[model samples]
Target: MTEHTDDTDDTIEGHERELSAVREEHDDADDDVSLSLPGLSVDRRDFMKAGAAVGAATASAGCLDALSGGGSADQETASGGAKNHKVAPGELDDYYAFLSGGHSGEIRVMGVPSMRELLRIPVFTPEPASGYGYDDRTSEMLEEEGGGYSWGDTHHPRVSQTDNDYDGRWAFVNDKANGRMARIDLEYFETDAIVDIPNQQGTHGACCLLPDTKYVFGVGEFRVPMQNDGRDLDDPEAYTSTIAAINPETMNVEWEVEVDGNMDNGDGGKDGRWFFTTGYNSEHATTESGMTKADRDWVKAFDVPAIEAAVENGDYEEINGVPVVDGTRESSLNQSDRPIVRYVPTPKSPHGVSVTPDGDYAIASGKLDPTCTVIDVEKLAEADDPADAIVGRPRVGMGPLHTAYDGRGHAYTTLFIDSQVAKWDIEAAVEAEAGSEDPIVEKIDVHYNPGHLIASESYTADPEGDYLISLNKLSKDRFLNVGPLKPENDQLIYIGDDEEGMQLVKDKPSYAEPHDASIVSADKIEPADVYDPSDYDAEFVAEGDESIERIDDSTVHVKTYVKRNEYAFPEIRVQEGDEVRITASNVEETSDITHGMAIPEYDVDLALAPQDTREVTFTADEPGVYWVYCSYFCSALHLEMRSRLIVEPSE
Candidate 1:
């Protein structure tokens, strides 16, 4: 109802251009006529205009129901839908879904069945609430890459796997914007390490898919020179990308395999013997037209153990301080004695590659086509011709992007153009001839443009077919009008074992955006509610013996302890222009009795969980008394928990 801003205007213009192109492609079909409403009549074109007016958001739910003619049926079946799967107040959910916070530079943990956001774990960005990036320990971790990077485009999140099932020991997320990968300690629910991936630009997809997470793997989505030190700027043919295998325990890049073209999202086999990724830019094109000119791209399969063996045998070249293996076709077909990579041709511009739960097949979605190519995982290494590896090409729907298995011989594919999810039988698809018999079992209309959808434990060896979360790209009129920008929608669909068809259960407003997520059963993860002081160094704990150690003329170290409503160091005095180091230890032994400290004028905040210790360093530049108080609620006397830092003027 309000005038569009400049950004909104640009967005509308872009959408208009896109719709115009769609109209031209369809020869300007006049099938979208006016619809008969209950009292008022609205044309389909006018309804689309309303969507465009709201910053080209997704269409209203009522509009989708009217178009699909299944609204009343959905309401009538509500009793048999997700109502049975609801988690009442004071009850716990059955699963933990870790969602990648796209562009927000974080990971969100949501409880399944309830769809409630339990916690937000900041990975690639600073979180002020938890004092993650501000604390001394986390700040040092962020400064590892020497760029002072603040934000990252997080894409895919994978929970560590053991024997192809959720291990729940660690969660890995990739920073697509900064070419970095982070590891979150599941027990502490905190980011423990961040490894800067060398010889890559955009780390779009990474996962700890092997058993016990032997090595975390990732691929560069963009191609660049091998060294990428200001060379081959104009030559597109000279550009290449890589897939890096990192040591999960050490959090270091052990080896990288150079590929010919840019790789997209990837998944590994259950045996940990092979990994597969979708490929594009195979023509080495610089322009969009040239990039999509080819009729088919590839689904590349890499021999994981073979590549590692090659690296072990001193057959890799060092680039950017990393051992780089030549996996490109130019190097493999001509120079290498044995092939370490196989490029199986698939439909144009594949986007997502997923391994089936049984580990027999790997499905690659065809983004530009209406099909998904299924390749045999074992045949990838033995097939003389790459074409022999592919077993099926099922025509799913318009703009199929990602596939999630139900562990019941069925696969659900997200249709971007159709705004729907199609369920198909995998074996039926493989047996039937292409375009002869429809392998699609059912199709459920999502809100709009669902980019990625994940079934409960879809990527693991044991997938539960209880529910599926559709990561819809837009929520347009789903909620109250916010502004020019609206939050994305994460729709919960009930695809339970006994259900006849998929039922739309609830629409949750997701933060900013989320690309992909992994749902693990609740029993798989057990995090610590209380911190253990013995795990940290003894020097970090104060043990109620508060003291100030003057290391040098301009340096001072103050050690303090905190309890329910008191501080060991009630007051600390320092001289102006002095470098001060303060160490605070929460001596509380109770679980969930966390403590925090904050200085009034200083940019310092510490989140001290029970029995947790933290340190902060700052320069005492102001010649005034600064009050430090507890930032986390502890007890009834929480407000009285305060200490004073007095800074005297330097002579």
Candidate 2:
């Protein structure tokens, strides 16, 4: 009984073997056993052995013994309860989370803490529910470049910022399926502009410049020919990608800087000086097998000021009516020229690159390796070699994809293969020895594989460490079995204090897939409850403008007004082949009162809030009386509100 052996291994592989033994001892034990840890509920031995074995085993033997006994929390479930973070009925949420609908082609506004979906703003797609693409005003915006796109794959949603903090005036999102970007006005909660990016394909990463949001930058994820005029189809070496800078005010492409490799994700500096994006395919691989051959990829950094200055000095070439600058390593290193782009080498196939809240360090996640590479941005600009800028390579876990901040010197990174979130200390990681486990504080298992995670205001200068959302890709048995397809699970975790750990408070089911989201405080955004006709074009009328004008022999412009239970123009007469343009204005000044206009046989629908005006244009080809009714429930007499459009036969 007194046999003592000091054979316990301190190395990672040694601890890994010890962890295997612990796992075998608990083979037949209940895996759902609650632990004394703040939010852990799995079997004590299994929890330490499975997702976070190596990091846990690095601790002293005495600490491991205490963890196995299950220390203190008397009453809690495996997924953590929501008693403390519950949002009562009729209560307002503390923050607003703008989520990008991956393939849904829209932006979903959700209330934080409550996980309630507030609105779905259609950006690059047509929505029959809100008449987004059906209305003439939005139709013009969609057909601006003459592309009839019905769907889009939105990736990232970035809010406009001032002084490195959210200003809440506009939100920018990218369409991965189509090379385009959209701007959503926060006040009206509507999309105002959509721009097709020139000379860039597969536009993936999008972010507004910090400190003032001077420009919105988007990076192309797929490499293609610079001319793209049916040339260099088989030459992988000739293909390259470019990062374009868009003028936020005009929503136009200002200039583009060509770079090496294919970019994936990006983040901007707090001072609006640098923009960095991850390159997952640095090998310039045409096939999937060739992509993983390289031991290291890169995070390409773009000098924004230098690019802008080059454009002003006309030190660039022209392609498709846009200025293009050569920023490749070969051209940048020639004769010691001022480089506009620098490629900082990182571990294999990096996925997401995010800057720290303080804007000091750029953390790039290693997708193929079990670590994250942290680079010093200031040093990166002047480094003679790309590898010299790297400060630390913290061993987090398997398949680290993205990182979020707590503003308390901590970083929470999502491990895709491990299906867990690893919380690490930033300063400790940079100062500790390589491969040391001191940086990793704790890790908790999510429901399934999570691709992206976001904390409250994590990307800004002042990150509030209150909550985090895990955008998991699978929800196997979390809810009732619903046919073959299931909704994605978005787990909400309370990440308030250092000692609280990550408590899984709720499991919110999101439709299809949601890639990324930006969380901001509620006080920063002030949405308008109603619209003002005075702030719109003169063609919109709130009073005394209900008349029909014959624009030409076959075109008519019908100006109509609406209120409670009535339409100003009860009947409109037009010829069979006449082109009809109808503008419906709601004159009600109440906060919640809204009106809808719909024509039965025609694909026409419009939603008008109080004091709002919208237009619909269509050809009256069918010679019949179409009943127009209110599609939205506004009042008790909603059923009685109707109008008739009589299309007479041609003489």
Candidate 3:
């Protein structure tokens, strides 16, 4: 560990006095501990020492695990008890799962291709009356304004699969507006539980340890109401920033620390001691007409408790006298500017945090700045001085956000400028430094405009060694139209390869507001998982055929009528590795809409024209139920024209 001189203006004498006072206050509070302030009894002196030890141990262990080429098995085991089944090695095909949020709400998932909706699990709500009007405008407005339908206001779902005790199933969605913590259950496809946390306002970014741990570490910003009214954004307080350890299961708060203000503070990197960033502060703004906008500011850091106390008391303010911007006046929080202190080439609105698995370097992206700042994580952890902590400067063109590293030392980041993804070689960075040359970061554009990138991973099946998945915020036009439509329909975007780049393979009138997605194992299926066709049985015969026949237990042959130019079918189910054959015959005039079936898991795509009877055979090796729809973006009832295929076990 290297020690750097404390570049901070605070003298050693002042720090010593503050430390002693904090220790004494902590000791006295221990004798009268209260349930409301759990984990508030530990002596500050001892806590800091213990924190250093834990931080060191965790960082070392993380580095060793990364070096060993350990896969997600360790993470899964750490998130909860080990399952009897292991994730099969390979890539799973991607598909979309629609979550019904009713009226105006967001549709969230894990990746772009496999958009599985994270539905709000029924929490024993009172049942509605038989004649209850679902179309009540007042009821819809209440849900929208009260955080029921606005997923964006409530959740900041970041990828946490690599943290010490984190499980892939637990996606952290912070309720920034209401200060609530939602642990989305991926296994059950619902929000299994909701934990109310104090000082949870502006719960921006969160991460967890692997497998079975109950706690998640998070950071949040604080705000004071304007004109004594809780709704107005006035008296913007900078010091109201904190980093907390929260128990997601019981909704218990462990501890929180306050970082320096004036520096925009949110997002952190956890290794041994949790390292965070801080920014500047601005005052709340009001127009001449009395309309107000919230304040905006820079980033900063803190140990934790100071932050919790500040949130409790509205007196907390940013340090260094950074001029405050009127929040009530600014359109976006990231747009405000404040003084940049400490680090060179100071970043504006620095938000997301990431560190190398080796504990060698740390990187953060400024929400407003186009460049990323890199620091020496290990040195910063051990340093007596902040100046000595900075490692190197590797500039990334365009605005950078959520970043991920392949255990092998390569880093991947997303640029929001053109919605392109970039790849970086960290090993090459080290070599460049050794040769006295700056490391060059490479960019591989995905051509998708992603608003907030969740995570990326290197897939074994891909030649580039990585497949990045990101969340695309709804376009402005799409966001304004969220709700039951004047006419019901869905929208679809088909992806296909082209000589120049990927092309819009097809378009459809079903599925809208698609977001984050995930890739799950496609190999797990059971015989019981299959669905019976009799559930939606319909009878129709071809122009020349008299009737339909069942070739086998799994196969069904249908006849079409000449009057019915196109036939609408019901959902089908099959087990993994089961062969499915759909034979269609056109009995009327040639139909313009091309008939095609897509098995997203198998990556099998086909296209058939009208008046042509064709049999498409495919093996559903994937386990989950997939929706099969016509590729052509045809008509008003396209939402109802889709069918489902439930893939089950092969036995």
Best by TM-score: 1
Candidate 1: global Cα-lDDT?
A: 0.78
lDDT of 3 by residue, 342-430 (tens): 22223434555555555566666644444455666555545554445544434443455656554545565655543334445665543
Q: Which regions of candidate 1 deviate over 4 angstroms?
A: 1-72, 76-83, 145-147, 333-337, 538-543
Cα shift from native, residue 171, model 3 (Å):
3.0
Error of 1 at 79 (Å): 6.0
lDDT of each: 0.78, 0.79, 0.38
Task: Report how far off residue 585 is in candidate 2 (Å).
Answer: 0.3
The digit string of per-residue lDDT tens for model 2 on 40-154 reads 1122233334423332222111111121243322235323443467678999999999999989899999999899999999999888777888888788888875156777889
Please state every model's RMSD to the true fold in angstroms: 6.4, 9.0, 21.8
Candidate numbers, best lDDT first, in rank order: 2, 1, 3
| RMSD versus native structure for model 3 | 21.8
In model 2, where is the ten-residue run with the lowest total lDDT? 32-41
Model 3 segments beyond 4 Å from truth? 1-107, 110-154, 158-169, 209-214, 225-239, 260-272, 275-346, 427-438, 446-449, 455-465, 472-651
